[model samples]
Target: MPQANVDFSLKETAPNIGGGRVSGSEKLTSSFDLVEQMHFFYVRVVRVRDLPRTRNPFVEVNIGNYKGTTKYFKMDHDPEWNQVFAFAKERIQAVTVEVTVRSKETINDEVVGKLAFDIADVPTRVPPDSPLAPQWYSLEDESGRKGGRGELMLAMWMGTQADEVFPDAWHSDAATVSGESIANTRSKVYISPRLWYLRVNIIQAQDLVPISRNRNPQVYVQAMLGNMVLRSRFSPDKNINPTWNEDLMFLVAEPFDDPLILSVVDKLGNNKEHSLGMCTIHLSKVEKRLLPIPVCANWYNLEKVAQDNQNNMEVKFASRLHLRVCLDGGYHVLDESIYYSSDFRATSKLLWPPTIGVLELGILNATGLLPMKSKDGRGTTDAYCVAKYGPKWVRTRTIVDSFAPKWNEQYTWEVYDPYTVITIGVFDNCHLQEGSDAGGSKDPRIGKVRIRLSTLNADRIYTHSYPLIVLQPNGVKKMGEIQLAVRFTCSSTWNLFQSYTHPLFPQMHYLLPLSVYQVESLRHQATQTLSLRLSRAEPPLRREVVEYMLDVGSNIWSLRRGRANLERLLATCNLLVEAWKWFDHICKWKNPISTMVVHFVYMIFVLFPNLILPLVFLMCIVYGASQYRKRPRHPAHMDTKLSLIDSAHSDELDEEFDTFPTSKNGEVLKKRYDRLRSIAGRMMTIIGDLATQAERLNSMLSWRDPRATPMFLAFCILASIGFYFIPWRLFALGVGFFAMRHPKFRISIPSLPQNFFRRLPARTESMI
Candidate 1:
């Protein structure tokens, strides 16, 4: 019966991955048992589509390995609604096809259909040997001839099978042509479907055991040569090293024993002109051995033992001695020991003081204020005057002298006087008048008129000038103008004052007329007008003034003192600078490379002066204290030798008087001495002086006290011993020490306890 054709759909479904539904027209079994042979076959999705709308679904298909595991498919077909069914059969064997139908209407939902096929291994047969097949002979020497050779060749007809098998044969004219025999032969050739034109020298006398005797040697050789061709997959290029050669095979070698030498090339594709000498390996020994050796063994001395074990061997053979290869510029050897040993330390002596020291300095600026000035200048005052005057006129004839005399005796006119007074606090126009005189005459006028009465120097009040004019105009018509002169003088002491108020101060405007006013009647006549003008005196001005002078001596002294202080501060900073440098230099040696003895000697010699400075200061302190204790009560110059003699006699007499019986005068002195001795004896006083001197000496030598010496020496000695014992470990410790040199970790020693029993016994007494 004809079979029913079952349809299959290929599907894929996974999170974030595109899913597809591909339907095949029918389920088809593979023509070969591809699973047994582990060969794959291919298939394609025939059509992929879904729903009523126009949008089409994505389709995917893959060929399966003969083991049923699939390899991803190449995209070969994409159409709006359908995919073509076209893929090779060998790549798609034993297919499991799943179909997925997806749409926006069911975005979260999925439907799947699956189909699988069992593939069978294809049947194959070996061809029968032909009577007409050609024979082959492996090459060998004949009759022991030096240049003897042989050759072999074979040919076969082709087949139309999917995989065709090649022929195998074993024929040799070398040695005995037996399995046990070995020979060196030439002129050999091998040909196969997978390999061609291969050659090998059969030179070793020993026969090579076949890896599998059951397997055909020619087939094995063909597969082996075919793999060689397959693995040589890269393209040949002039730029690549180990330049590809179809006829050549290169051997790999050990990096340490047979290191590949390299040549540098320039941009022009040529070898560099100058020879860069090759390095011959000369490895120093592994430093680990130095760890186990007693630290007492001088590192400088035992280095030869280390060198012997370095595992360095001179290279003897290399397949390709030198090859030109290009390397990226960024390539660098990262081994620190190799780089540091070669580029740095091995080439130079060990530099001492591995650590660095830092110093801090502070700068300050200072200045002063402005200077003061001195005193010198001043001035004096002004003057004033006042006047009053009147004008008149008359006519008389000499013929009527008697009648005129009688008229003169009877004629009297009241005279009104106008005087100008220069007053303070009044405007100039206030004391002014302009009109005719009392006689009503207009012929003569006076611009300025003053009457000189008596000089009132003491009162400072002169009379006003009331001028009297004689009217004698007769003989010559007597019509000439008459003139009058007026004068006055004043003394300031008794000057009359008027209390005139300023216009702005109306409350104080009342006038106080002078009591000493003396009037003088001086005359001028026929005045056109009596005009008076007033003027006020200006007030005195007030001022403040001064002068200055420099005291050069005081300035010089101040300047000198300031300069001296500045120089002293500068000197102090300079001392600190030098000390800082020296101390910093020493502290840097915390990681010194030299031995402890070297450091000890350095500390003793280089630091001795500084250490001794403290000692000298201490000695000076002791000396000062002792001198203070021995301070003289009076001037040291007084009494001189006499005082010393007197002191000696006093001490002796005081001592002797204590023990001996005395006469009346001596007894009285002894009784008084006993009372004085109770206060303080001469012997006790001497002993106290001696004790103080001893104390001073003892205190000054306190640095050498037994306990202090051990502790101080131990610190220095241990630091020194660190240099000898643990070089690397000590280096690490020194790193910490250097870090500690910062303020946060400065080496500050705690205060030491003082010895209350201040003196050391003599060596003899201690021994006894």
Candidate 2:
């Protein structure tokens, strides 16, 4: 994947810290900031005019630092893209739209023409209901002059214009009372923003300054980013080096320019806490490395705060904290990979809907759920379903105290890519009262299923039962099965490519880019709509065929987690064993005659070590030529059929064995027993014959082959006899030379073993 170059100059400035002094309660509340607002905009690449002759021409558009490309249109001077790109407000403030036309070639793509435009130049004063008309702009070359490559057409807009109210209505304090105004306010609008996930892992803290000399200190970590605050569990009975491998996730709306504040504090009496030391981590410095998922794990020096009034300031206690931080781009967009393009024009001909489609999923019910254990020794469970697609999440109402729960709810989602998966999980809901400790009793996860849209046939509704599979610490088990109905409906064929402008499909019509959070909100609304629809139904859906598919005493989850490393070691060991097995099979003595001949040759070599080379040369001329001349014969009558008379009797014997334990008279039983004894004797004879034939065949095949095995054996025998006469250094040098040249004589070895071992550690992870 190509990295997008983003310009950060246009990013919105950080809000200023409040100047007024705050009370104690206000300070506590202000320490944790909630994400309140998001920004969105749209960019449409209309078309590109006349361009120089080039092969496979396409346009690459760069906004801020992110880049996207259009499909290459072969030998077309005027290519129509008509592709719309959306961005979060934070991603495009100071960024310029860099449009470059390039021709794809065998070696590298060549630039045909290039143009740039600052986002500020685009007109944003157009009415909310109307989009700015596409306008042509002159293309420029390296010198910033007209390149004569022709012009490009583009249209840009912000999400604010899509609002129903005009600019004057924004300043009004009173709520609109008209029926139409009331309906509009009740409707939902989805605005997508670029999202980043920041993960902070607190591993351990070293020597620290204790508040009390007599008492052992208990330590915990607090991390602050913007207004969000995350706290780690207190370390078990404070030692000098305390480890808390806890992960904290924070959502970032813009580039991380601020430093993450880490304060290590000591627990005091009456729920009081005192800061021991603190450290500041600047994420901007980490971002410059440009890693896909950057991780920094090291011990950072902790600095004392000026507020500390300890008189022993000269002690200079060495303090540090081990931390690991990573910034991840969540839910990669389909636009990042060309293979899964969501553009209507690119996929229309090959897809069923020939454009974007809608997915309807119905969560019907679950059956034969394993009863969750309760404190009162009662087997019961309150279960609910949570389904996620892209950023959208939907949760069904809890079914109280039922092993077989029925939801009968239906929901719809926008299907952008058919290949993407939708995850649905069932959990045991354990609600706690306010002021109750969360650690008292935790909710248990039931099982989950992931369904891919592409696997379902379009326009066809399927109501099928799927097994709920879960991986527990002990093993994997089937808690129960969920019955679901699903269907995919494509937009009308006539209006598939036309812009949607209906109020019913607000999300599709407005064409505003969405973030993960907005998508989840939309899914929640769909779930509520389904709930409402269910209430109106005459007789709601019910569960059927209560069957439990449970496989106890099997822990496939643990096996899967550690299988990668075990598989690599097993594979390498298998290869080594196979090598020795082949050697043993090829070098075995077949008969007394052959064995005696081999022993005679060895005895001659042992008697005259100086003449070992001469004997080997002579033997090769005689035996090697004879072996080469004896070409192995292929099987004759390979397709011959057995005579009916010869096999007819065996059919009767097969039937007799198939019904061996039949209830028969005494005379019949005696006859059956006698027949079985005779057959067993014959079977043993056949087995002996088979083994003998296999050994003879293997020896014959080895003798007829003109390869390294026979020569290697002869050389080993000669070297063994010669070793006693030759010096140790000379023998070692000869062996090293022979081994070094073995690759030239043998077939090429594969690197599968090397690659497997290299990637094994990454596959096996230790739980933190």
Candidate 3:
């Protein structure tokens, strides 16, 4: 599929989103974003003592125009807030950083004490060195003389980002956030829990006694893991003994606390069901198999529940269920789209791959944005950005009440494969207010962009403003635009290139590939497991968000998707048609002089065939160079094509949104069936044509058609004998001359080879 790409680029240098503006003369086009280098100045406020007896004593940190306040300590003389405040050196325009201890008890909010550090006096402490120790600073009054109000313990040092505290420290870049919620804004790393594929194979059941003989029972087996459920087809024979060779798979993590529940279900009249017998299998007791080896099935005695007058249930003997269950740890569970999977590691920890490179993302800002919803009788948007690459996901602080928000934040991930994608999404922060949190409403999305690493040139910064497009029930909508600067730095070029020669997945995938049904089922299980795990993290990812990101429902048939794919196929096929038209025009001598030039060149190449390879390669080079002028700057995602849409039937749209087993009535189902048959009829013709072409080629050698085989053999024998006697160049030259003969002498009919090949016998006659 072709994307709509644009070259909306940055102004050479990194944007100064803090206190100052960058001049055009200072802009850099080098590999490095010069303005991104930072001297991270940190001020760690360990504790405070000898404070005035007042309620709510807090410390305020101010650097340049950025201000951050510590938590209030009510009625406490001494407050300890082991909090750190950091600032970007280049963005700090002030000569000194001021830390003030203020009392919130007074009506005027009186300042208790204040201290300042000159920018030149700060010590430069490199990483791997011992951290700078805190020193007691004497409280000063308005006159700059020492006072007895309070003494604050502070550690001030300028260090590079490699410092251990760089990740956890609060920076001025996100100074607009409240002090209480600052922790939620900073970058943090999260590793996904080790997940394994749990397989449950139910073979057969024996000696099942029916509770009521008068009622005919339709029996089937059902398996449940957590919330996901799977059912086997009902047995055709209504008997005590039944067999259902079926497999149900689930994604399970460590701890193994969840138990797999299996039950034999019986269907009764009036659309009712009864559990005849049930059994539980603890995951810890289930066998663990890394490979796809056959495991012996074991019988678990099922139990029947009976209730007494006291309501206590008693377990009674029932039939036995034969099952084979195992924890498969060999496969790399795919919770993401196959084309955009960030991780390629197997379930077992030992099978993890090595880190390949470093991926850095600079979230510049967003522009031309509209409020997601109305607020306070006016439209406003509190926008924040969330970027997820590999296992780590980072969320920036919400820039409240702004159409264009600038978050000069950068994040990095260890890239294991160049094929992985980084997804960045902008959303309206719904959880900021108390009411929304109580209701557990998720943030409304603004837009999302996915950048695949393979499309990027290594070691270069690509800055572009990508349009944020959202797909709605009505059609595709352009939400806004977001500017991002991305760079992918490879750790080892050899290792990165060597990965291309190796298998895309683990070797086991090629050796023993999973069935299409299993792949779909397991992918569903993987998404469920991932959503469950991510929802448990600090700032939870909602189920809808995860499903949207992973495209869980994309596999369900969509007429729009089918039409788009069909268009893509036809566009590819059009190239051949256009090429043949050009060839026909040339041979028809539409341009006599050009046709003579083509004939002259063709004669030279045919007579001296050794130059053919060179000419082909030279043309390839010329075509590549010509295309350089039309190269796309930024790799685009989410091409919005609203053609209203796809002019499909109402029933087709309903069927597209239907569940896996379908929830429609019989009438609607019949209409869908007729539509599907009509579509498949055209598809069957295409497939039959392709089959005929292949079968005709086989008939020449297989002797399936006696006349076709003899004709092909005679041509082959005559050509082979002539080639052995005459020079191949002379024969090709003679053929070229004949093809380029004057238009008056040329025959206005199809070639002999085309006529003969069209007459070749095919197997279409054997079709029903």
Candidate 4:
């Protein structure tokens, strides 16, 4: 095997190559430390020459990555080693070589280096042949029965030299040989129904020398598994192939994006089949197999075979065994054996006034062999026969093979109420009659209905079949619920939804009731309410029937359109859609021009009167201001202290001013009003900054509440009223203007009389 040739075993003791006295051990160790710190290292080989004359001569080199994997470099055993040395030097950097061989031991005058590769350097694609390569066989694939369409794949490595081919199974360290080898490399021919696939690894190299007595040179090669594979059917606990004595060895390849496909075909028809939703040809060894789908059965019929004697005697008899097998694969002359058994008897007036006839059958076996069941061999076989014989003795016969007379047996049977049987029929809903609307709208009930069964004799009891009644509202609807009534025969002990079918269902001697009842409603409301009722044959009123009436609740009924629980679901959906469309129209519509004009006129009428007076006064002032004469400027008082005292005692002072206490004898009160005004102005500036900072933070957390819009309008009205009271204060108006984009502070008197303070400046500076 190529794996053995490329021995991946780690060898740490490497010889130094310099053709001189070994020295500088400390320096070498220091260099290794530096390389380790760098987290990278490289190996350079000088050459490999002078090998035996084998089919392929290869030298294995090791540079650890995953554990220590070795790669083979093949070269010829040529005397002239110059070309080989050149090849090896080109591939590797000599300065940073981690492993080197300086001088070789002389064997009969031929100097072979400690490491075979360093003996000589050569550059060539084809390496010398090695003895191991010729003895190994290439794993290949061949087709079995079908037109030789087969493929084969093997995981191995690349070698430098020809004879350096990887080892075969015998030379491999991980070849398990207890089980049979795959017949062909192609999966189709190597079908192993008893085993499941593990993994497949395509590596660069695989080689191993026998290292222990217990471990063979060739060990088993099982597939590699990641987490997903380990969780599958072949877990470690059930890994049959990998025993403790065997270990799968390989050059574990790098993971790939795509998955591998394994296919196999079983030649022997001995495999058991299971119709678990599909006709699966079970294989224990192979993981999976894609089926070659055959043409489906279209025109088919149940057929009972009649046997003719090998001799000249003529006989007329129906075979005991009857099968409903499809003839899609074409008619087959079955040479295999057939098994069957039946019991027949007559009953008296036990079936009531009708005096019904009953024929019971006790089939022991119908197929050629026993049913392939579970590992424990529980009740895997189905009860294939039943009937109501009306309390009478019935004769029965058993047969191993219908074709062979020696395989027959006989037995006696009696009628019973609770027995089991298997029956099959094709479902045809087209011919069924619509059930009568017997159940009222409020009661949980089923309409009078009967399932039409064909080919069943009147005397035979139809037990297992269940009758189902379904009612759907008529026409296009958005919301509605469906009422279903499923009644089963009293003999049926369980419903079909459950896993186990009650054995008594098939033993009923007469027609049985339906097995299930259901009321399926939509979750959404309807878009339209239609009064047009369903036909008389249809059950429009049946809405309460359910599989289990007590289990359903009104909470599940929905107002949402198109929901399952909504009564008249389709209608409800349509109605909701209409409402949404009406709202959408209101949103998209533009008001008429006449209406808009009326609104505008009304608004002007309501507001124009209040605005007229202010507008008229403003206009008069603007017009009259051009004709007014300018007032003469007043001079400042130089003797302000004497002037103030005399002015304070002036007779112009009102008696109301006398009420204020004087600062001294008959003196005017010394008030700090001017200082207070100055301080108040400074405080206004600080307040403005604080307001600005608060406003900034408020803006940061500004969230609009739709419900607060009305309150905000009311606040604006209050602010407007407050501002109206301060006629001459512009700052007051600014404070009231809460919706202003940016605020500025200025003091101005809009209504102040000019003569009131003629000496004072008209507008004060801003506090900012």
How many clashes show up per model? 35, 11, 0, 98
Whole-model alpha-carbon lDDT for candidate 4: 0.21
Best by lDDT: 3
Measured against the true structure, the TM-scores of the candidates, in listed sequence, are: 0.11, 0.28, 0.72, 0.12
Work out how many backbone clashes candidate 2 has: 11
lDDT of 2 by residue, 121-188 (tens): 66554232455678887777766778677787876666431223221121111121221222211112
For candidate 4, write residues 1-768 as lDDT tens digits. Answer: 011222211112211211122222322111111110111111222233333332222222222211111222233332221111011122234322112122222332221122212212322222343321111111111211222211111112222211122111111111111112211000010110111111222111112222233533222222222212111111122121121222121111112222322111111225532110101111222122111132221211112223467545433221111111111111111111000001111111222121112222212122222222222455122111111112121111111112111101111222122111111111111111122123221322211111111112222222221211211121111111111111112222122111111121111211221121100111010000011111111222112221111112212211111111122223324646896876565555554565566566558646664433343444344433432233211111112121122123222233212222322242222345334433443454344334333322221112111112222334345544544454434654665675453436432222222211111111011000
Error of 4 at 89 (Å): 19
- The 0-to-1 C-alpha lDDT of every candidate, in the order given, reads 0.21, 0.49, 0.69, 0.21
lDDT of 1: 0.21
Model with the higher TM-score, candidate 1 or 4: 4
The residue-level lDDT of candidate 3 at 524 comes to: 84
lDDT of 1 by residue, 710-750 (tens): 23334344554544445544576887888667777642322
Which tens-of-lDDT digit does each residue in 621-728 have in candidate 3? 454445445544445455434212324455555655556555656978867865664565446445445555554554445444323444555556565455556675
Q: Local error of candidate 2 at 527, Å? A: 24
Best by TM-score: 3
Cα misplacement distance, residue 744 of candidate 2 (Å): 36
